[model samples]
Target: MPLNEDLPRGDAEYLSQSCFQFHEVPGSKSVTARALFLAAAARGTTVLRMPLVSDDSLGFAEGLAALGYRLEREPDRWTVEGRVRGPAAEEASVFCRDGATTARFLPVLAAAGRGVFRFDASAQMRRRPLGPLTRALRDLGVTLVHQEREDHHPLTVHADGIKGGHVTLDAGLSSQFLTALLLVGPLSEQGLTITVTDLVSAPYVDITVAMMERFGVRVQRDGNTFTVPAQPYTATDYTIEPDASTASYFLAAAALTGHRVTVPGLGSGSLQGDLRFAQVLARMGAHVALAEDHVTVTGAPGGRLAGITVNMRDISDTVPTLAAIAPFADGPVRIEDVYNTRIKECDRLEACAENLRALGVPVHIGRDWIEIHPSRPRPAHIACHDDHRIAMAFSITALRTPGITLDNPGCVKKTFPGFHRALNDLRTIWHRDQ
Candidate 1:
């Protein structure tokens, strides 16, 4: 498939069969990309197997190439040659499109380079906030100027060696800021000491720690303070585990559609924090079986969905899936600890409520939490707001309703480029263009 092609659209009404077979481990592309960049920063050759080849990861690879790193991709693995001595930052520009992971990770890498370079992106990427990271970079003596909005993207980084020190951040918005600093902290001249205020999505930081260890870096954590030692990362072979966040949708499908779904690559031991989503499924009355390399979910008998309240700070990525399954439950479901969702690809809370209302589900939105009530079935075409999670969440509703049409279904390419194909592989699909 072409990189820029729109996602294929089809009426999900034809999804009547059960049982899904997923072969690959759901690799965490975000972790893989950051690990690869760190390997490159270490100036040694590193081999990464089963790394995610999604658009976001590709964007990061492109930015690294512009900075003088050579990356070779084989059918089964990728090799990155590091530019550990720092790249000559001679006025280069990288277009990150809508990939925020690229937009954030590359700037920190650029901060460690020699000259000045510009990083710009599509309209959506430009709107994503970069204040926390930009401020952190500035504190490290690196010159960073935003070309457009004050805290938004399309920024320039004038390279200088990192002089890390005590820093504080509001983690309520996005964990990407923390992830960016953590990945680059090992290269700081004095290392880094960070204090976080109101940190949200703490599990993501755990993933960062796991990746850091894989690259031969150790971070000391005492409560909210993280201390990094000035040690170079060791280049070694790494393999990315399957994306637990993406697997949430399939788990939800099994819970909602009475199908026995098996998502491979997520077993008893996975580094991704979103793996805790299986606990959420078990809480919601689904039968969950954890195997050595995969998880199997079976729907409750007679589709008796349970109601529970959860603070999803660590697993905020699965909020949309939870919201999609809310209407089928026996009582109201409350999802909290997700104020960060407001600034994600879209205002997920409002978008989810709006989409659920359009489908005739009674949903009440709060500043962070949303309460969803069961209602009579009413199928409607949903506006995805160009958010991949939103599009996937609503697609689950199609299984219960007559069929829910998704506008701009192609947004799934942001993460699972083969999402539609994977869905089709599980069942017979019927699609028609309007």
Candidate 2:
């Protein structure tokens, strides 16, 4: 799967010949999804500013609409009329498409209302395990029955209402399980106390708690226990920051191509933990300037970096981004503690390892880790697994190696529909300067 011709070899490598300041990414999908849920649970209309318009975000809104929630979606703004009483429709069948947030969060939201809700997801989502969240809901007195598989999607919730109290949850596989329960905590008659035995993607839960606070609900935490009182969310106008995870690709591109890429609206004040990927690049010899309102990454000397071992337990979403450029480093890039990535749209760790090997790089995969070694990468067709992150990450590899095309480039629609066009725009600038 080489391109028609190689554009960046011999004399014309896409280098740091230009500065790409004000490189803007789309809105945060995490913040947008949480905002939609909070808005639906509030008592007044919530105005969302600059929310992401992607398949995942739109699917969440479509689910809301199916449940009889009213919304107005303009070009750059979305307004949701709040309803504390839960789904306006007595019953609904929701297709979660391929978003894990929609698949996981909606069922619990339905549990808080007095209705029987049937939730099903795409074949990809159905493969992921939902047992932990389902068990936690069952423990809360919410009756659920799996239709096609045990502890899987294609399930029905015979919801009378949630009289939530105390529940023990093991969220080691996914943090959405914990976040979903926490989101529905206020709807219970007696509130909720969630004792988490294990967890992953802890930063996502932090996002949930922070957004919940913005909607005027307080969640108390002591060690591993979280306590949320019976309360109603207060609706308000909320501005969503740009996606830090998506910004990682652009930042990594800047590092590998010896160019400068600055992202606006995601700076030091950003709520996302994935912004820390910039520090990871900085540690690998990139020049990173994180201002109060923006962040910029210029490539390292000669677009070269020294590889290092890093733990991505908190910011695992950027694992693929880093791995795509690992071959350019001087040493070995070892990423650790990212097991939860396996349960995503695809097994991301192995997928990264697979594509790296396809390009003639040395890569090793463990149960929860991957180590990529430096080598002269030979371009080949990349297998994208239809995961948006996987497709976008490998597109970075094509910049230097060239001739790298994905089988499913459109998978980026899950969060970033315009990813290829945006990356190509920057690529065009870099190529012109060269």
TM-score of each: 0.91, 0.95
> For model 1, how does the per-residue alpha-carbon lDDT over 175-275 read when each residue is reduced to its tens digit?
88888888888777888888888677777788888778878898999998888887888888888777888888877877886666777777666666676
Candidate 2 RMSD to the real structure = 6.5
What are the lDDT scores of the predictions, listed in order?
0.78, 0.89
Q: Candidate 2, after superposition: displacement of residue 383 in Å?
A: 0.4
Candidate 1 local accuracy as lDDT? 0.78
Report backbone clashes per prediction: 7, 1
Top candidate, metric lDDT: 2
Residue 82 displacement in candidate 1 (angstroms): 1.1
Which residue pairs in candidate 2 have backbone atoms (N, alpha carbon, C) closer than 3 angstroms, thus clashing?
16-258
Candidate 2, residues 62-96, lDDT tens digits: the string is 99998889999998899999888778888999999
* Candidate 2's TM-score: 0.95
Cα deviation in Å at residue 323, candidate 1? 0.7
